[model samples]
Target chain A: MTKRGRSIRVPVLARVEGEGALEIDIAGNRITRLDLRIYEPPRLFEKFLEGRSYLEVPDMVARICGICPVAYQMSAVAAIEDAFGFTPGPELRAWRRLLYCGEWIESHALHIHLLAAPDVLGFESVLDMAQAWPEVVERGLRLQALGNRILAVLGGRSVHPVSVRPGGFSRLPGPEALDPLQEACRAALETARDLVAWTASLDLPRETQDFPCVALRHPHEYPMNEGRIAATTGLEIPVSEFEAHFEEYQVPHSTALHSRLAGRSYLVGPLARLNLNRDRLPPPVAEALAATGIAFPSHNSHFSIVARAVEIFLALSEAVRILDDPPPAAPALARPLQPRAAEGFGCTEAPRGILYHRYRFDADGRVQAARITPPTSQNQARMEEDARLALERFGLDRPDEELRRYAERVIRNYDPCISCATHFLRLKVNRR
Target chain B: MTTIRIIGLGSPFGADRIGLLAARRLAREVRLPPGVEVIERDRPGLRLLEDFTGARAVLLLDALAGGIPGRVREVERSALLARAAPLSSHALGVAEALALAEALGRLPEAVGLLGVETGPAPGPEDVDPVWVQALCLRVPVALERLVPDRRVAGCGGRIRSRR
Candidate 1:
């Protein structure tokens, strides 16, 4: 009997955020080659930012990804503010945190319910999953809407929000808006807690692997909009020093650049954040997570779903806390800005992971150059590494369909925002 | 409380703005009944479900690719569901949103979609003003067809274009 080599190809990945495919080469149970191909055309947002006024940076960068526009805006504003040596007062900082909480809730809820759940629940998509578990779907949408409501109250609209600027928000919400949002957040706390328990209870795959976890870590709070870059590999640095430690380079198979921490693929996003900042969780969120009995510092990437659920709980609680002290009618904007020629860097924990931005501005405050590193691209190398290892552990002798499904589940665990990464999960297998 | 929602699902870019434009015109020109609310959304995605919830009925105005530009027609629920190919979670379209709503049993008892045809790769320049005027004129008649119990004021034959 002759052993024949066959290639299987999935033209487009489903349920992700952008265009990408996967190709695996196998020779007699040995995985020879694996490439997580990110084929989406590179959107040159950074290039477009050159020569734009500092004021336009936040809005322009927000157009990068619909799901996490606030992340872009937050990072952009933070960078620009840093450039001008402007530190927002306590009031502005609190509101910015609340706004970021809204984004975390929205993006995490959408991913946990719509994108990642179907794979674990043995369904083709969220629509099919909705047929079997309507209550679950409804809860997700409700929580997600609450998140969007928060964004609308602060940023003016959820998708590509507009109120963010270098100094502060364009207009602050009054008690009329804050009161209801606070009430909603308080009500949703219980729902978010249940979601954490529910996600933990799922019969998730137990394939754990060794990887370095990376995320922002703050001394007093769970990291979101501000923190020092920290990793499980005993690396800690300011956001300004990110480029010195992390390197992003292109590979032949992907349009998105692959990132490495000290030349090693590292993990980012929910799992990484949870691993690094579990000690910083608020008491209620900490208690809820403890109740799940899923220990933090988890290496299993599948636990990302539970991590997201936990963050949703944290985000809702944070929103409640912030809204309790609504913004004063004095003014939302900071003192008039005086721009100077300088360079600045900002790194925030985007829903997927750390989103970094660096800008070089001229004396007149126009951007001389810009660099943006979204989370998905940072996770690309790690995703490819995970796929190769996870597939081998799952056994290479399985049918192509099973292998493909397993491989996709691995990639989706990252919740890769392909549009953000130039990102992906079309599966192709070449077997001999 | 608004029992019927007329949502325009589109963005500010190019021909995609048609639904939003029409929605604005509807709110300004048409004298709708007390319970009918006209609103415009910029690519509401799954957020469209919120517009459907608690409403007795919903009418969605959107731009459809293919066919003659500015041609207005009814899009059936089945067709919308059939088009629910959610390629990416980020690109969740109206069809997927509607299907999810139906699946969760949250969709309104009465729902109708009115799509204005925008040819492939439509740009801002491709949006014809005359065609938009014609489309806007027929919207009230379409609304009457969708909800028979309500009559839209200023929908008479002698209606003049305010533009």
Candidate 2:
């Protein structure tokens, strides 16, 4: 008698930021196929962006994902400014960096506490983890709030901020605003430090892969809104040169386009950023990283949590540094803009990873075309690779439920923003 | 510390804009009591806790899908969390946030989700006008329910009532 077709399926990927699924198939103790599917449906954000005024692009693109709206806004503003040959003054740039720090802290905190930690601790959800570790959950909430506080001060509110534009912000916060934000950050520093320590203490599973890592590289500081795209494989390219070397091809299984560099999958996000810029971290964060006893350039994706925690520490320190020297009380908005027909590219390191945006503008500054490549879409191919590798390493004969959970763990390790990967798919494993 | 926070939740696109529209209408049509703060949000998700923290009460207005078009429903937090799955595609949604708040003990003394049914409307304008009017009419009623002429200990030891 022949074994019938058997497969494992996760119809709805849970504990993730967006919608996705997973499926695997095995026959006679051998895994046949693994599909890391992201079927969230195409949002047509690129199409929607066309014909919109350049001024509205920042706010409009921010809606791409609630978790990292700032990333979209930052990339949009940068690209638009690039097209117009404008760069913000040092103070304005620092403010943008500070805002980016807030997003990192907030987004990373949410992932560490709510999404990833539960899997490491063997709980179903953060709510479940709270039952036994209330204090841990409380600290996470406080830290999350601290991150939001920074955004509220800088962006005007946490989500879909109304302040950003092509040239500069709508308004600049003065010393008075800076005082409270600084004070609040000061209070939260201890928690941020403790959170890093706590994350590092988790018994992380070690599964190292030799995949190439990529992120933004800046000479003087960690990359956020501005930097050259660097890869561990010794590839360095300006943001403008992104399309020249990399490609995003549509797969029938996913709404998101699978991205590759020189026709091969690469990893991005926290792990990649840390791998590329460990030495550039602030001294305090560097000290914290050393204390964790984890080696630098960790190949284990599980260490991504540590990368995020380290980022939170760095963001907090940077937030304090920026706040201490508040911008002048002069009007916060940048000089009036003069929009002209142009094409531009913007790339930034979101909390999750690198986000890229390209836009073409009509003579009147209306968007003629737009292309956005979110971090998650770039990570999709790598995620599928990891799932297959996990099954191979963990054993194909494991119980179906156990394998499913393990796959979910691997997927969540990337902290995928399925909404951002609107071009996502469902997962399925097929047995021969 | 603010005693009352009214948060209108939704995006600005299509039918999802109702929460924001209703919020703006309430802000203009009704006079807020001294301690109440009205805010508009584009899907704050788990950040709802941050918005509602330290408040004595919270009234969340949102455009709800999968119900009668233009119908309004006032739901208790407990009922909402009982089926605590995400209602939106973009974020964790209100139910999961409320559940997290409940588990963390950060919930206010009173919380209500004012759901305005979007029905089959394609866009903001397509939604029945009656839904908007109903939301406006229910704002005061919800406020009264939150405060209700009672002094509750969870309200930070302040004696509070609606004007």
Candidate 3:
């Protein structure tokens, strides 16, 4: 007796951020081939940066992903500032960190609710989830709005904010502006804390696998705007040395590039960040996670929602802490930068994971060349690897719809901003 | 108290900006009712739902794909919902946002949408100024029809009530 070959094709994947497809081939109960096909046209952002003035890079990159515009802006400015040998003041740095916190909250909230929660809660869409869990959905929306408010205060608008510049912000909010934000964060803290427990209490699938986690690790704080790139495999490298350790390459099936750490697929984003930087969390956030009784350094990819929830708590707490001290009225921008010819690298912990940017500037301060490795691209390989392991563990013999749903759940777990990566999934399963 | 909120949703890219252009023009040219407000947003996504809060009626202006370029028409909520299969959460369009708003019970009593057809393959610079001006001239009339009682006072005899 021989097994018959069958193919299950999903033309488009829903409940994600961009257009993509997934194809899996199983042979005799084994996933012989899996491709997370990203059919969204390549955005060509890196190439667009070439020959543009360095001043425009921040705004240009910000257009890459609306959900994490601050990440792109921060990374671009960090790289450009490094090229110019400029360092912002403590106040400016704090503001940047605060801005990054806004992005994390907004991005994570959207993912946890609109994208991932429906899957976890066994709803077809967020609309369905909202009908059953209105309060939960409202909380997510409220938190998301708060994040946008913070971004609007700093960046001047929530979407593709225009206020960030190299060295410091182009504009700074008055001290009065911080008052409402501080109060809002304070109000949201309890909600964020509850979110952690809520996500933990969800009926999440429990499948742990051995995969190295990678994220930025700061000695004093949970990694956000600044840190060394560190991985669970004991690899630590400065942003400048990222190329020496991490590699990105194209696959035939996808338009987005897949990245590897030291020649192997590795995890990035919330789960990886939590696993690697659990110690760096604030005491309150750390205590909240501890209360969940789910230990960190968690190998379960499904726990990424929990990680996001915990980080939401961390972001709110950090927002409160940062806003507690009103920024003194000073020149919002540092001393103007002089055009220089140099190479610079910037790595910031985006909501998803470490976003790395490298730039070569001409003497005229034009971007001679540029490369941006977004978190989604970095996590692509790991997502595929996770999907294969997860589907195998899930039993490939299950009904095609069940297999497809399970695979989608595994991929959506990462909350891959397929738009950011030119990225992510329609599902096709071929069984033999 | 802005009871009627007209949100023009678009990006600066090509024909996609028709909504924004219409809204801005409407704000400048049309003397809207006391409780009416017009504003532009650039690809607000789920954030669009926020525009519905505290408003009794919400009218959304956007660029529609297919059909003759510059053809303006009223888009029903059902039609929007029917076409909205969001590929990504970040790319949640007007339809999904409205659906979510309805789901969360935040949808206003009266919701309406006006679309300016952008034709196929709209590029970064493909918007026609003639269509934009036409949208500006015709939208107020559509607004009158949609809201019924609201009278648009500006533009003298150029704008007439479809009623």
Candidate 4:
């Protein structure tokens, strides 16, 4: 092969949420650079939070991501509540967990069946995939609807739910309301199981790499809205210490910030959660994972789809269990919140990974400072590293189109949410 | 639980708010049929599909990007279904949502869309009064189109171009 410099540019990546571009430079079989440019203009959500009352944070932040509004709401409210030293009663806590599960199932199903599966099945898009696998697509949509129903039941509506507030929900759902949701989850559980089996049957590439897996770890249950931040690198810290352990810095090529733990890239999201918290999975989910035969502690990021499928199974099952034991009806909002000068930190396992929120409030409870680290930004550095490693393993001499597709698959495996991260611009391939 | 559901789909940001403004004006200025209801939404996608269930007639109002700014147009459900193939970048497009609802057998008996043309997404300050007037002028006529037999009695409002 002649020694020549080459570059692969994906002007815009499809199937994943938000807008992003991938650029790879190769000089004579040696990879030179891989940049995942998230050129979407910064929405400046944190800055937008300034001067807004604490009561408005959840709704304002929920606008940050349409796909996972509940994640933003959960993390925002938890952090604000931490500032006020407030905790919902057991009933509200259980409902919060149930809401989180609904988000997980909905987000994971969308990624697995609609976004990521097309790349694995070698189709252009989910619509194309649906032609060959209509049943699978329908199942995914139905599951997604079920997840939305959960949000609707508890939060009042799917997108930007109205019920979730800082202390608790605006309204608590009664036992009778859970009947249809429970039945739906039962049916979804079966479909989710079949989904897990189907995804496992796919011959996904097995290329495991060593990276720090970061997520929240609870004492006895799967991490949802509460836990200390834990990493496979023997690092554990309270959510309050997140600012010290992790930092987000920006690059000129992308508008979104890249995150690092102790000046080094790390990983989060489904792969991290599954690897770090396998012990916390419910019995049925554990059984399903075992049945897949894909070993735990999977390094091959491609198995993320499989991991997501397992989570869908877990979420539907969890929803059923939550509904089976309904919380007694209680007022959604706690007593009138009193504003004080305090700072609080909140970290929760979003559908993608660990989402961190910190807030500083004045005596009036107006926001003085706000910091949010979405999972996508946290994974940006790691995603770039994965791209470099994948290119090296796949061969630099691969055709541009092949390389582009490979890069897309590698990025989609992380399921980046550029929309939820910074915002959208456009992706263009400047093939020089 | 009205048989005739009128939804205004929009975001509060800039020109996107035209749909919401039109729907609000209609709800206030017009005395709609006995079983008619009007709603304002911030941003809607597939969720709009579920709103179609059990309705005898449905009329949607939204802002259309990539056209003459402030221009109003009436789009039919069939046309929306025809163009639903390529999904939009933001969540789900209206055409795709309608198509999905149709596929799931949830579309109502009569459905229509009335919208104003908008430019590139503007900030909050870009709520064009001209665009608001354009859509408002067409809402009552659009509603009549959706519910042909129903007596919708609120046509003599301030902005009565009827186009």
Top of the candidates by lDDT:
1
TM-score of each: 0.93, 0.86, 0.91, 0.83
Task: Tell me the spans in candidate 2 whose CA falls farther than 4 Å from its real position.
Answer: A1-18, A27-30, A39-43, A329-332, A337-341, A419-427, B1-42, B51-62, B86-89, B108-116, B121-163
Candidate 1, residues B1-163: lDDT per residue as tens digits?
A: 6477888878766677778887787777767777888899888888888787678778888888788777887876677778877435666789878888888888875777887888764434445665556666766666677667776544523435656
Output the lDDT of residue B155, model 4: 53
By DockQ, the better pick of 2 and 3 is 3
Model 3 / residue B149 / CA error / Å = 5.2
| Candidate 1, A12-107: lDDT as tens digits | 122233466889999987899999876432237777778889987887777667788899888888898899998878788888999999999988
What digit string (tens of lDDT, one per residue) describes model 4 on residues B29-141?
77765788889976666567567777888888898876777778899988877877544325577887777566556678688998887755332346667677777777668
DockQ of 2: 0.22
Model 2 CAPRI quality: incorrect
Best by DockQ: 1
What TM-score describes the B chain of model 4?
0.84
Give the poorly placed runs of model 4, Cα more than 4 Å off: A1-18, A39-43, A419-432, B1-8, B12-42, B49-59, B66-70, B76-91, B98-112, B118-163
lDDT of 3 by residue, B36-64 (tens): 88889888877888888798877788888
The TM-score, computed over Cα atoms with residue i paired to residue i, of candidate 4 is 0.83
Per-residue lDDT over A1-432 for candidate 4, one digit per residue giving the tens place of the 0 to 100 score: 111100000111222345677766676766677778864322376877789899988877776677888998899989998999887787778889899888988888778877777777877666567667767767777788788889889888777687888877778776677887888788777788888899999978877787889999999888888999999888988999998889889887777788899788998999899999999999988998999888988888999999899888888888889888777757445466667899988999888899899999999999999888889888989988997898789987667777777777887888776422212223233333
lDDT of each: 0.81, 0.78, 0.80, 0.78
TM-score ranking from best to worst? 1, 3, 2, 4
Give the range where candidate 4 chain A is weakest over 10 consecutive residues by summed lDDT. Answer: A1-10
**Residue A353 in candidate 1 has what lDDT?**
97
Candidate 3 chain A: worst 10 consecutive residues by lDDT?
Answer: A1-10
